[model samples]
Target: MKPEIIDHLSEKQIQELCQLFQSTWWAKGRKLPDVQRMLNHSDLIVALCHHSSRQLLGFSRILTDYVYRAILFDVVIRDNYRQQGLGKILMEAIINHPDLQEIEGLILFCQPEVIPFYQKWGFWGKSDRLEIMIRPAAETELLQEKAGSLMN
Candidate 1:
């Protein structure tokens, strides 16, 4: 069955997204309130839902300055839904989104195993001029979901 593609989600759907995040190793510890906050801070959101049950099946988001750069994040599909072209649907939707078409770059970070999958979209190692940097932070049970979160 064809899934419904949407840009916005309801409260219940937001909870569903948190659940989806849990299915992945990196996002395993995501919490509901944190997910809500993430949604509020994101520039654009893409979600695919089950046609009849309204369940979130695939999701991705973008942060862009509209003309200079855009970073794609959390591109995920439910385990059972993988290999069904939903990831392609999410990527095409992001690339073709009217608000993002003029953006000069789309960036994302993924594990090496999936590198080839994204090459079809023209993604590759960026210029040697810049690379990612990170710091170690302790985990929190509560009272801080965005300890290092910053979005505009």
Candidate 2:
């Protein structure tokens, strides 16, 4: 059956997506984002593939501005649905989406082994221009607290 791509997922759908993420090896044991948090972000894009009966077969999202840049995220297919080209279909739909077509660039961070899969969609690592950094959750909380105090 042909899969349908849905742009907006309901709260239930978001929960299902989180569950899917948690079950996967890549995201296993990872904390899921809250549904309200997902909805509050204008740049968030959730693409879901559903069967004729409306069962979710695959999912993906992009964080982006319509013109400048986009970060592809959470691209995955249910274990049973892999190897059927559904991943390609989902990625193509996201990359060629009308709202995303004008983007100057798209980015995603994947493991070394997954480089070839992303390369198929034209993503390349910038060997000379890349600097990776991480800020812990405590730092994020401190920032949020400072911002809250300034607002009051």
Candidate 3:
């Protein structure tokens, strides 16, 4: 069956999204409340769903100013649906999305090994003028606070 791209997600789809992220090495053990907050705050969320079954095959989101810049995040295709080009389908949806198409650029951070996959979609890493930087969250402190709360 052909897959359809959708911008809005139902509560069930949001739960599925939480589960999908929880399975990823980068986001393993991500909390549902955190996922819900992310969804609530994002500029856009898109998913690929089976045309017949309507099962969510892939998911991703963008945080954008709609005119100047956009960042892609939480891009994942369900494990069972990988290697069938669903990723490309999802990227195309993002590229053509009305709210994103006029932006100056789209950016995402992926592991070094996955560069080729994104390169095919016109995202370049070799920029003479641009560099990527990050400030990671304080995981240990956050975890301790969470545990401390649970014990109360």
Candidate 4:
């Protein structure tokens, strides 16, 4: 069945997304309340849903200035549903969405394995002159502890 792409999502749909995130590397510990709050604050949320059941087959969110920058987060497709071009469909919706049409940059970070997947849409890798840096959040203490132990 052809999935319908939508700009808004319900709480149940967000819960479904929380479940999907738990199965992935990037968002494994993501909480439902956090997901809800993020959805509430996000500039845009896009979902690809099964046309009949309205179940979310794919999802992504954009945090943008609507002018200078848009950062993509939590782009995912349900495990049983990958390799079907759903990601391309989701990206097309985001890239073509009027709110993002004039943004100077759209950015996302992904695992090395997925570089080629995003490059198809014109996303490039880190360059020598450009570096990405982040200040780790205090909320990541557990992850930091785990990594610290791994280094021991």
Candidate 1 achieves a global lDDT of 0.83
lDDT of 2 by residue, 1-152 (tens): 56888877766666667777776654554445654475457475646566555666787777887788888877788777788888888888887788887889988866677788888988897567765544445657555553444233
Which prediction has more favorable lDDT, 3 or 4?
Answer: 4
User: Candidate 4 regions off by >4 Å?
Assistant: 143-152
lDDT of each: 0.83, 0.70, 0.83, 0.84
lDDT for position 61 in model 2: 71
Off-target runs (Cα >4 Å) in candidate 2 are: 30-36, 139-152
lDDT of 3 by residue, 41-95 (tens): 9999889988877778899999999998999988999999999989999989988
Query: What TM-score does candidate 3 reach?
Result: 0.85
TM-scores for every candidate against the unseen true structure: 0.86, 0.78, 0.85, 0.89
Winner on lDDT (1 vs 4): 4
Screening candidate 2 with a backbone cut-off below 3 angstroms (N, C-alpha, C), the clashing residue pairs are none
What shift in Å separates residue 62 of candidate 1 from its native position after superposition?
Answer: 1.0
lDDT by residue (tens digit), candidate 4, 53-132: 88889999999888899999888999998988888888889888888889999998776778999998899987789666
lDDT of 1 by residue, 1-152 (tens): 78998999888898888988888756877889889999999999998999899988889988888899999999999899999999888888887899988888888978777889899888896567975654436556321343333110
**RMSD (CA, Å), each prediction:** 4.6, 7.1, 6.1, 3.2
Choose the strongest candidate by lDDT.
4
Highest TM-score: which candidate? 4
Model 4 clash pairs are: none
